[model samples]
Target: MKRTGKRIISMLLCVLLASALSTTALAAEDGKVLKLAFTDSPTLVIGDMTIYHPSYAAMLAFKGAFEKSTGGEYSVELYPNGVLGDAASTMEQMLTGTITGSTPADGALSAFAPDIQVFTIPYLFDNPTIAYDVLDGDFGRQLFEKIAAETGFRVVASYDNGGYRNFTNSKREIRTAADMEGLNIRVQDSPVYLEMVEALGASATPVAFLELYSALQTGVVDGQENSCVTTLGASLDEVQPYCTLDGHLLGLAFLVISDTWYQGLDADTQAKVDEAGREATIAARGICRYAEALAVDTMVANGVQVYSPTAEELETF
Candidate 1:
């Protein structure tokens, strides 16, 4: 009788522990956590760059808008500064439902959707306005649908990443394509970037965006191309003192969520998520444009040489 009682007690304790764990899990799921990850510092203004980095601000906007629209039924948790990992990894996590969403650069998306590489072609969009119009129009919706069908990811929103990409280096200022020759340049882990850099007469070195600073400081690459906002936000000016406003590529970012997860949400929640994403997109674009406008002056004030090529000189490329 004693042994039987002991066995019964053990079974009861196991059942209770299982019930407790199940209840905890259920509570967490009921909270409807939306985890968004990105790889940029929360603060952009350190010296002359006086604006909150859009990545952080926009995520906050998304969180606030979603919670407000949902009447606090959902909670958003943001992981900035690559806390969740770099773009590629975070995107993978999102794909597997390990993360709810992520804002990855266009180049990063190319890995999963090869068609996205077309956007990375140098000078695809002449200006931000054109880019915005195209992205926010029917074409953009169709493209998103195609991507969803192909990758199980839905692009919830699109926004300017930094306006335009330019070359920055510690070696010297680049004035023409000739100037790029013989210099090893760090390019994003995308073939289009590699081809673009090489076509510009530089040796293209593929590097993760998170490790760019160390790569530049250690002379792994002589230069890198990025938007002024990214250059300043990452403090690349500290490592690279020269910048040429070549504007080779129009930078863009996409806020993507797992289509599977999104489909699971009810219609009301889905609409709320879309609304929040739109708000976040606007916030990101505003800050990016503001930063781009001030970036040249800011970088110059911060002891980095900023140069704009003459039309004739620009044509030399």
Candidate 2:
């Protein structure tokens, strides 16, 4: 009889514990949990044992700030590596408030906001400071407001997507445009990139970023170009043997939140979100200065031949 009673009490305790756990889970679900998406686009890298790409680092900083400022009532869940979906799909989700946020490439965003194309012009900014000035000035503010009015994705912050893009290949050293001739180079799925590749004397091949690594590995393309952080993050450095610091396009990434979602948040929460975004931008830039130096050193250490051509040499392309 005592054994039976003890067993019954044990069952009751188990049921109570399960109920408590379920209630806690439900409460957490009821809280504001935001889904922020970004791809593996390169940025300033932070790694010792493991690398945290710039975008992920910015996301982490934003998440930590936002959650702390909001007393842990708000949480950010990152969807990196295109797990939530491709750039366009995730941007659509942000508009509909299906996903709360995303920081897609400015090239990808240009399709929705045509004004962004101007920034993609080759060698537009002479240096990173000028790029920062333009992006953080009235021009950037006006464009963000216009985009929010048009697309429902409101820009909270903008950060450099690594430094100026450089050329990389498995085939040959690229000191001039003549070296780029006939090279089957993989370009982003955008007209600006296609035009740039063509102008450089290479046969431009459009490829989805997700498929780029395999394409390069399988001899689908002979070369590609992007910032150093991007090359390392994508592990393209392992397959590509030569890197030329061409200093082409000045890349940008926009941290955008859904208008509908932002509107739903309380004024204080909204302010906190904006503050966190700015903090992330600052943090990312600081990391980039150090990261660029380290990234090049690491690639060289890994046996990738690094070359920096003179401005006159680059103009030949």
Candidate 3:
């Protein structure tokens, strides 16, 4: 009887230990640090200012606030400056739960959600305010929810990159669509971008951002289309002398986190993350706008002539 009782106690102890281990594992999975990655660094400028280009900066603020809100139960890890490859790759990682978050623009999201292309349509937005009203208001929020339903990413913040324009190395200014005939220009590898460039009557060469300088130096392409901030930030102004202020399209970036990872976070903590994202977005937009104006002023001061497209000349594209 004593031996049988001892054996039964041992079995009970084993069951209890197994249950404890399972609980621990469940807790670990439930509250692991959220890992975030981004393609751009903090100093990247899109429009008039330098946005904290990575989602990490915003995530950091969220982490602290979330931990406080949750009584120190949750945390986050940030990997900025393309540590996990390009934005698209990082986004893939987010979906797979390898990384938890990323910041991607409308152009980047177009791959998974083609409806996003509507925002990419050239000259669709007249000014920043209208763009913000559309995106931050009912339509943009609805699009975000739709995209989240289709792709498992959630949007927490919205930011402006810039108003897309053009710059060229040639002495002849691009006043109308006719001026772009046969001119070789660089663009990002997107079908929509190709369409826009083709509409402008220029041969579009898709090139990565890092390789653009060499391409311009070797005369691989005559010029490229980008915002004022990017043109000067990347030092494209040195190789390309003329800048056309066409304001062809505006760019907006979203701070997105994996839906699975986000769902794991408690409600209060999630709210904190969303709030921090908005705060960082405001800071980034301010920096980009300021940087764009500064870049234009600085470049013009340095003998780079800048011109705006005439009213009639703007409608060709």
Candidate 4:
């Protein structure tokens, strides 16, 4: 009777252990991991230029919305401040399925989807409202489909990179195109940007975004052009004391994912991903617009001189 009792106890313990292991396995198999990366500080504040930078905030919003909406069927991981890599490298990773997604500037993405460079054209969109209408409407969907077909990558959503590109310099204020002459200006390492700067009479010097602050501080480049939020986020306003509100280019970026990974997901999951992307896009655009609206005043308080060109002065370009 004692031996039989001992045998019964052992069997019960074995059953319990097996049940625990099975539950663990099921938990592990229940969720899929989605990794997203971008290059930007998560948060920054200088004077009144407070920023929960769009690149970082949008990814966080996507992660939260996706996880909740998917009911734990999928999990999102974010790599910010170039923890994974620069914009170009991150985009390459997404293409190869090394990463699930990334937010890359149109200039960086132009390498893979040349048509995206059209956004680089100076003054392409007259205002933010128009830009949003075109990007969030049917035209944007058609463009995304075309890009997916060509590159095997899916563009999930569009983001306002800051607002509009403006010129800032360590030298004198640039109120007109003529004021740009003889200034060695830093530009993204893209042909279109180089050409645009050269056409404006400045010697265009291509510089990596990471190295821009040091380059400006050391006089490697006399000035650079970017949205006010971008300039303030990087503390470029501290180095470049003068600003010209030229509104030359509408800053834009895309949240992109591997089409292969996306297609592999079940229909329901894909829909959830798309919904998350839309939410993220809204969060990004809102942050950019808020920052831009207050950027000039913030810069002024911080000792940067800002000049807005009159219609006549603007046409001088």
Best by TM-score: 4
lDDT of 1 by residue, 197-275 (tens): 8888899999898999999999999999888877887889999989998888887788888899888989988999899
Q: What do the candidate models score in CA lDDT, each in turn?
A: 0.84, 0.81, 0.74, 0.85
How many residue pairs clash per model? 0, 0, 11, 0
Which candidate should be chosen as best, given lDDT against the real structure?
Answer: 4
Candidate 1 global lDDT: 0.84
lDDT of 3 at 198: 86
lDDT of 2 by residue, 27-139 (tens): 46885778889776433342342455567777888988997897666768888888888889989987776888888778778778887777888878877888889878999
Query: The CA-based lDDT of model 3 is what?
Result: 0.74
lDDT of 3 by residue, 148-206 (tens): 88899888777676445555654467888888888888988888778888887889999
For each candidate, give its TM-score against the true structure: 0.79, 0.78, 0.78, 0.83
Give the TM-score (vs. native) of candidate 4.
Answer: 0.83
Of candidate 2, the 10-residue stretch with the lowest lDDT total is 41-50
Q: RMSD per prediction, one decimal? A: 9.3, 5.9, 10.2, 6.6
- The TM-score obtained by model 3 is 0.78
Model 1: residues with Cα > 4 Å off, grouped in runs: 1-31, 46-50, 170-173, 178-184, 203-222, 233-235, 238-241
Question: Candidate 4, clashing residue pairs?
Answer: none
